[model samples]
Target: MIKSLSVDETDTNNIEADVIVLGRSLPGVVVAHRLRQKFGDTMDIKLLDLSGVVDNYSSRNVTFQVPLGEDDRQRESLDAADVYIGNVAHRYIMHYMTEFNIPIPETLFRTEVSDPPQKMYQYRDGRVVTSPNDYHEFSFLNFFQRLELNNYQSSLDRRMSELFRGRREDDADSRTLRYYDRTSMESDLVSFLLLSESRDVMRLVVRTVCGASAHSVSLLFYLHQCYRNGGSRNYVGGANTSLREKLLGYCRKRLTRKLQQSVEDITFLVKPIKTIRTYSDEQVIVETTKGDYNYVCNQLAMAVRPEELSKISFEERLLSNLWEAVESARGLRPRQTKKFQVKYAEKFWRQRGFSGEILSVRGPILWAIEKPVYSTTGSLEKYSTLVGFLEADDEDEANSREAVLAQLVELFGAQAASPTEYRETEVEGFVPRCEDYVALRSLARTSSALVVWGALDLFADGDLAAALEAGHSAYVRLVLSMRPQAQDFDDLSAMQWRRVLPDTSFVTWFNTLSYNDGFRYVMYCGALYLGYRVFRKYIIRS
Candidate 1:
């Protein structure tokens, strides 16, 4: 059973713990659990949550009624559309789940039965075009168009592989990495679209997955996210389904199957932290809003969102010292996403021989996928759950439930008009859009007792796997600090969290041809030749 500390429970003047972790996110939980596993009962470790919930990620989960056997209606199903287990988070999540005896859910791509038809339909100019296994097989696309699409996809993957895994110790490659980081995805897309593009496929793909327009997203950040956690092969095309489809199939109302054990051994406190005052690398005082007690801990790990830091008060020295991190956190812009699900009694799309996957440029619905539901006995049920996302920040009309249903009706016929249950959730969170991740890294503060960990702080990626990795790294650092003699762990300690502002000056950008090293070199040679010619002409005239 889940347990938490009440307001009256923490009425003591002082509460002491060896370590205190703030934020109930996966990263914070991992840090607390790892520390407990390492030190056992020897150390007093405490994990705190403001929301009074262990897994804050699953807080948005919706539970609804599903009819059970003969006059009993207790049987129910979970709908967890937002939580997606990516390839990066798979290994770490599996390890913890197995240790805690958590049951894994079925995969969206490979099921007990044969694979479903693999296709994503795009509603183009008055017609629906299929996203096929091979672009060559797409009859609507001409040979040149097909060739361009294939080239673009392969080139993107290849570039991402190099930027992420290539030897960055080299100067040329390092500069190249920085170049991409300073560039926007929209600029890259514009260059590609200039070559007689038939449709805005790249824009659609980026918008559907990122939940933001290409112009706002950093090129390097976008590619890094796609490249991380097993890259594009796990989600897009061929054998695997797209990210949108995976989210739809993964709609679970409860995470019990995923999290049977809630790390019950550790002491759990339910209070919103008001301030963190750091004196040295080894000692800090944490104050909560509800309790008169002050938490004195040897170490404090921050696993919350970057923006959340503004809510808590820190010592003046720590704030002045970590100014770059504070600014980067404040610089992060909000990315709004609205997810909706409609449930029906029948699998209408399957009956019509449809894949239930759609990508549309039309109003309201940006993307949609059909998910299959199973009964408690592990048998496929005769129900349809259509889950999709809409652009919440830009589309004002698409904000309503009625607008969504009308769009669905237009796409899936009269049956879409009535859904047994319709639910929608709108989320406004800070994403790594235009933020300088290089600066965010400065918040690592590994040497200090106040270790900060945000989604974009270290790996510059926001996937669950990255968060788990961060938690593990923080644990190792904390351990090494306490035990200086131990050196078996990987040397991830060299990563600097200092933020470096990109050179956006007009002269600097002009000289580098907007960060194009190759083009700049060409211009350099041209200028030298022209200069020599002018000198020769002056000498002859004299």
Candidate 2:
């Protein structure tokens, strides 16, 4: 007989759920949603978040751009690979939905693509392999000129697309198709090159996408398996909401209904969780802020970083290897990121016949997204705003903003850069620093518990997507291990864990000196993919 678990009386038992999600971030939300989709009303789920309110910035602030290089061949390769991966990922998620008898809107399957621009670059092999949309075909052929290279690229794309494509014919409205057209070429080029060089490249690419460092992660961590297997068309308003606002809205609609009314403190005992106590082969007692809570599961899936996990209390002495791995995991010092939104009374840039997306490549204000958001009242009377982000490292916040504004004015002239209202958001935590990042990865292995032993595998080095994927994978593995079926022990475990390994082959080839341009392109793609994956996974889980 299946028995239900209960929390302390002080914790409101008013809400009953099968899962108690601890955090309300993106991962939490994603997991919650997925579970709901899988079990519907049968699964009682609740969420407990720190702030009691979901921050929408996580979703609305995102800028989705299919990075295109100046080379045609490189662009084709990247575009093709992106499409292949996206479709495969989407398909895998859809399979889960079908297996679990979930009901979702049919519209979720509809994906859309924007028109291809005239001038574009495909960067590969550290050079501009092709330029202009007109030369895309020629560049693809030229870059893959070698008989073996061409065959490999073609085969990889075909196999990936075949495995994931739900729709028989490629349709214009498919976002997956559009992404493929834009990024597959570069991805294939990078994949092929990495497979040829050190296997570490593929591992790096995969880990980078998942949000881990190459040195500690396995080479098979694929983000495609962690994605929601489908796409949606952008609303007519043009995805105008801020990232934070979008995520918060989703939380309000789905998560708020499942939370307990009290706040619980989180504290560590004995520095780290060493031995987890099991009683009568039924319940596992864990130390928490309120006291010891009994959990009936054989494994615990934590969504926190390895460094954070080290702070939890364990009942028994953990294996030396797991302890060392956890101890070795690096802590990330928060970095400061600032965003400035300048609103103007009129369309000054448009009046000057300029497209709002302009780049002052050499200036502190690198680029600007014109008219990023729309007024809530549905009137165009509101002023158009220019949103600019500045990368400030160890600099005074006020000074950095001033310098960026001043530089913008110099590039666009006083009239164009002038704004009637200015708003800025300063983000302090996990600043993106390349040097410090490399150092952290080198130290992240500090645990020996099979679960904690893979602490290094859990170190994302700031790749949010990989972190989210790892969390989900961990959760799934934990759950399956507790209730193992006859057929569940085969290749499933390998496939699941392999998804956490960094694809070293891909990383080495993409980072090769000859493919510097492709390397940068791949990095950007990996970062964005990680962010999206993390947000989706965490939000639902929470």
Candidate 3:
């Protein structure tokens, strides 16, 4: 039987736990799991969320890519040629394969190239490096033969030439030999020979309202996070299923089954709690939608968003400072962010010789992922799917959808472009807004006991994984300090608390330098910096 805990019938005096964790999210779930894993069943731990399960799916489906214009002008020029090469080759091979109904290879690993148009251009260290088009294709064909997919490759090439019989020889050459060969070479070489190469190429760029800018975040931190264990590669179920199903499976596996109870009004204790007065040595009184309750604990852990806490009344005015930090933090509007999943009718995309992924410089959709998963039979077929994420509001959603569809049609033709399903999740207060909150610790007296946690605390430094990690660390320290046997709490040393909490000064420095001038500047510069760093470290790292 699965053990479950519920707040609906919680008794304050009966509350028996060494630790009580409030709120539920990725961070909360992690903290709870860690505690349970380390301490076992000895501690009575309870996790409370107004909503039973944290719905990460709200903003999970869509992953953003940086605009093509952001690439160096010289690299862009090369990519243009690469695009021409890739299209021609892909189109020819796809036509060839289709005519013979040959099964295209299920996996395609394209080579990443970084050749600036001019020698004068300084290539950013760790950016992707691609080979010349012809060489790239040769490498791909070599790999195909090694993998014993040469039959498919030959048939594809032959069919492609036949399809374009009347076209100019150069046009045919561009499509059949140049593009097809280079793409194949790149994919094959990467899979077979230089498997250890770390190109740091930009694969998928996801845009969300995280608490901080991209540059300030550590690259390694996100690689292991964002998804649960096993990382992105293990998460692939195949092209037949949507990404959402896979993600939900991960969440289900890790989330605590015991903490599935609903939180009722009367049983929850609210801090600086309204409509209740505490007597000397009396426990903190709390009022909830369900009823009234009291909590007696040596210490408290607050995991609520700062803005939400600001609405409550507090006896001491000093508490307002915490709220001020929260308001100053960045946030997102509900309708501004959207998530989409688009599926292709068949695996015919590869027959056209295109990688499953595409980035548009000036298109309605910013990025597309091809064949995100596989089928039961293990054959790459017409049932392949592509997932696309676009930035749009309710008013622009329809137009954006149409625009993305048109782009797909242009790239893969009408037969390959069709919508399976589209989902929109309106997330409010989504962006990171926490850097300043971390800095405020400097201004806070060592005697201050109140500390706030949420997006404001996490995003202040512009690193989501770091922020979440830091938040967890802070909670651990706070809990340790409050322990009866801990030296700081026993001795009442303010200095000890400083060492336990974050260095507010460092947080402030990052907030000021990175998120200066509010949301707009952060949106353009801060986010881009964060995205690029993440791409280099997590997405591209081999």
Candidate 4:
């Protein structure tokens, strides 16, 4: 049932398989692994990727770091609940680590930043800037006045305040997904942020937050990004690469039945699948672009985007909702995120008594962090380093070396301008793969092997938790479909919308704050901490 296809092997080109999972996304990998876990070697499975790569950024070499911070009150509140309140994003990842018996690597503090944020310099038309150490008039109130010349900031100022000031019931309108879906993020930002000094300062904020220009994203999608990341001030270790390596590795190891095994084993093909067709008998045909072979299967699990899904010519049109999803999908090509990582033999910035974190509205970098390669020590680690990120427009390496050095000289002193070694990459955008979501119900049961709904879940904020849920749901549906005679099956997606994990500090802090506190991440974070101390222990506990 599971046969590799080649031009020479005409007999096996149309061999029938039980299931074919497409794309190597985490969801697809999980589907492949779980189906193998459930079905064993009794069924034929073929995992595929059209890109001929396992990961989107597989070719790019970049070190990952998870940010670490918690709203103080949220941590305490979560602690009192006496349940697992670990990072929801990486929660399933940890589960897979345990299930697969693989160690999740803790990334080192590879970079360091010696300065605290809010030392940020904001510039406008004519490179108008106040020194990092001196933005004396830079409170939330006057910031709009300073940035607004043609009423750009003025337009968005009030709306920005209103967006955050609403109560919980107000945000409960995500049903059509259209409440946040209909408008572009640019139109949303138009009320307040302007491209001051050739830089869309507001655009940089959106890019830093959502990973795309406002024009490319939806307003509600932007809000969810803030809501999901827990208001942006939270932190974690970093994107652990070992989680992925182990998960995929384990699936490959377990799914590949040995040559001695009597049952037909799962097989994988690296070729890009170009077409999919289904027969009335519930059998499926998958073909590659190179005319190497055609595959016959009962089902297909897709882990790619909708637009990519459209590329494969299906023998019959899928469900109307699926077609709508394909048409409505935000073909938003994530913008390029440029970063610079500099390594030093000494922790120079830390020696000067700084946190090494930098945030700027000027140029070269939107934000940068200096982390130590060794996690135990912060200011004195041997592998001292600095990593800087370009926000939006100036992401390209245009005279980047000079521009980076100049900014470093201003913040961390002249010594920082030179490093023993440095690396840069246009890291993948942080934006979710899909903005306007295609409802799963609408696309459900469209074809014999059209398990494409799970891939769209990736667009549901790009959070690993979301993808895990989506993939798990697809696996259940696929199981029920293949075994129509089976009387029982569990539906995980049915209850996905009911779970709620709140970060106490953000909710409490957000409620207490004035509506005018917009784009002031530092100010809000400081106030969150202050409120936690007063309200959590002193007043409430008292």
Question: Which has the greatest TM-score?
Answer: 1
Candidate 4 displacement at residue 107 in angstroms: 7.2
Candidate 4's C-alpha lDDT? Answer: 0.48
lDDT of 4 by residue, 209-277 (tens): 554666776765555444333332221111122222211122122212221021224434456667776
Least well predicted 10-residue stretch by lDDT in candidate 4: 70-79
lDDT for each residue of candidate 1 in 28-71, tens digit (9 for 90 to 100): 66677777776788878877655565542343322222222311
Q: For model 2, how does the per-residue alpha-carbon lDDT over 118-214 read when each residue is reduced to its tens digit?
A: 2212122322122222221323234423333334323433433333333333232444433443343235445555334222223222221322223
RMSD of each: 9.0, 17.5, 22.1, 11.8
Give TM per candidate. 0.73, 0.46, 0.46, 0.64
* Candidate 1 clash pair list: 78-252, 78-253, 79-252, 79-253, 80-251, 80-252, 439-499, 441-497, 442-497
- Ten contiguous residues with the weakest lDDT in model 3: 116-125
2 or 3: which has the higher lDDT?
2
1: Cα error in model 2, Å: 30
lDDT tens string, model 3, 143-213? 42222222222322333333233343234333333233223222422332322221101111223212112
Q: Note the Cα lDDT for every prediction shown.
A: 0.55, 0.35, 0.34, 0.48
> Candidate 3 — what's its lDDT?
0.34
